[model samples]
Target: MSEKMEVDTPTTAATEEKKAEHVTPSASGESAAEHPDMKLAQAIHKAVLMSSNKIPMDTAHIDTLKADLIKMSNPSLIESLASPLQWDLSTVDIAGMKTANETTLNELEEKVKEAQENAGDMEVLEARIAVAQFAAKSMSKKEALAMYQLVLDLPKLSSGKQMDALMEQSRVCSFYSDTLKNKDYIAKISKLAEESGDWDRRNRLKVYTALQNILTRDMKTAASLLIDCIATFSCTELCSYPNFILYTMMTNILYLPRTDLKAKIIDGSEILSVKDDVMPVFTLVKCLYDCDYKGYLQAMVEVESVLLADRFLFPHAGYIMRELHVLGYKQFLDSYKSVTLTSMAQSFGVSVDFLDVQLSRFIAAGRLTAKIDKFGGVVETNRPDLKNAQYRDMIQQGDLLLNRIQKLARVVDV
Candidate 1:
């Protein structure tokens, strides 16, 4: 054994502290079956060897070791140290050696990070799979769609499984008429419907899915399918768009002016005359075109269960639908706040000056209150107590406009 060896180097404070705690016992008590003088000699020898070389032992570490050694009584450790075994310092040197380029190691470390990220994605995929399975088993199309979306997002997921889950969600959602957030899912199902070759189901699904795609503003997909879907199926029972569909899509002047679908509106005018069932939808459509916010909101209330999907008139119409459906009073307040003279004028498709004059007449007749702002504009507040008498007189006089509303009601296609 060498009298002095520079074998160990401290890399960290904790390592240095551990070395001090374990080092002194190996040095001071280096012999057993020896007299006090011999033990003292061994301690001195260790002290000389340790002091001869600057090994960087911390004083704080040394003091801690000294205190610990006072309590421990393990003599065999001293005997073994007296005839100290040779340490394979080669192994320690190998451990201490590192790559020259810290950058290269950092790059390798980044690869390891990427692998961990992939592993996390795999876990997410697994979770999605589990959720999908649960949703399918429970027949919860909405929940399944949510899970399928997660599965579709993972780039590494098996395409076969992704497609399978997607199809499953699509089938269930179509059957239940559940809405999905992803356009791809809708497209996939529409294609499936086309391939399956069921005329009624396929055509309906195609139109519904196309509408869903439209709801997301994927106009290219919608345009691609609209003409084909309309041609493929008759709209007699299902009311597929630009024809029998009495929902909010045709409620705008933009829809009315479309030449390709103009005859459908004229047909709708006829449909209005047949049994008067479509009145609610026609009225809503008119309100939408007129931007009669309050009237539209009020009309929504007369319909039972606004939560019913078919009754959900607007496709992604936002708070306009939500407040009217779930919080009517709040929507009422918002409508009142949004009202202005220009709004009323635009609603009637007339000049602001003309509307103001009409409003002033109503105010003078005590049928409405003319709230004139300092900036020179008026808001009409209809008073039922005063207006009821006028409404009765109008009813008796058989006002042509009121008669038209009644006639529209007679042809209302519910």
Candidate 2:
């Protein structure tokens, strides 16, 4: 009986060992479930399920929820969270809204082509057309332009509708740099703005045109238009750059005479709120205002790479630098009819030859009616008599007109 029990014990022990092996896997799984990463994943899962029960009605919240889920740093788990959010009933409702928007878009297609013989729907049509145009613009320019043309060609739009369409078209045309197209669009929009009699709309359109010119790096036109815009706009309008149009206007205007816009300019608080790259610009503006030539030059040098990399300011940057030189000389010479070149150079902290070259440019451009008395080493200002200057200008213009008339007559004779 003892021998039989010993043999049975070996078989029982082997069976017990087999059971231990099977239970070890289940024990290891339990240990893994206690791991920090696993615990975190489970916590995230519970959070998501809770959130799903009280999901936000707003679609914008969906992005926030997705962002929260991605923070878990577990690819397998992220996939699980992503899958549920993808087809969540809330998102499904968004798809329904999109379908309804598509139907509105189709109706807009017909409404744009035919005048609703009903005046009642005209206001609603305008609103719907605006929404449709924005959608089409995002999808394709060709489609947007067709809609724009339909609105523009409409013979009898309300001043309000015309203003809306013109503003939209002006803004859209700015995406392209075609001179002819921009000019044509500007002409049409300007006409519409004029007929609307809304001074603010006209001013805003000028600013829009100026911004397009800036994007094209046509600084002269941009500057001219911006100056006109500044005149038309209130001090409040020029204070901050809420739009690219305003931003370019304000930054570039810093280089111009600021006597009129002193209070209207962006301040230190405003500069701090802007980009680090723009800090150099504000610094340059300060240097300019303080008449700190050396500081201004250094600021420009510090930002030269930035200027070249920037599309709007790059083309005119070198010109602005030269303008600084001219401005320094002009301010220093504002009191002097004639001063020794060396003395002027010393006052402005520049070399005699350098000063001469800069002054020569101003003289040649007729900006400064002055002559370099090389022998006397003095710059003599040619103070023109106002009446005589006007007389000379009139004669020069008359001569140009006469020459054009003669050429036309000669062509006619032939």
Residue 141 of model 2 has an lDDT of 38
lDDT of each: 0.42, 0.52
Model 1 TM-score on a 0 to 1 scale: 0.30
Scanning candidate 1 in windows of ten residues, the lowest lDDT window is 24-33
TM-scores for candidates 1 onward, in order: 0.30, 0.52
Off by over 4 Å in 1: 1-169, 174-182, 189-202, 214-244, 248-262, 269-277, 286-374, 378-414
Alpha carbon lDDT of residue 195, candidate 1?
A: 31
lDDT of 2 by residue, 1-414 (tens): 111100111224546554322211111112211112222322343344445663224555555555543432223334445555553434333344445556766766555444344333454356446644544333233455566666655544455455555545544443322345666777776775543424455566666677666656566677677656543443122122423333443345535565533443444333345535466666666666676666766776755645543434445567655665565556556667888988877765678898789899898997676789988889987777999989999999999999999999999999
Model 2: lDDT of residue 212: 65
Q: How well does candidate 2 score on lDDT at residue 183? A: 63
Superposed by TM-score, candidate 1 places the C-alpha of residue 50 at a distance from the truth, in angstroms, of: 87
RMSD of each: 34.1, 28.0
Instruction: List model 1 lDDT by residue over 260-361, tens digit each.
Output: 333444344444453145455455545543456456555665432221223223344443344233232222223563357776656545577865675555
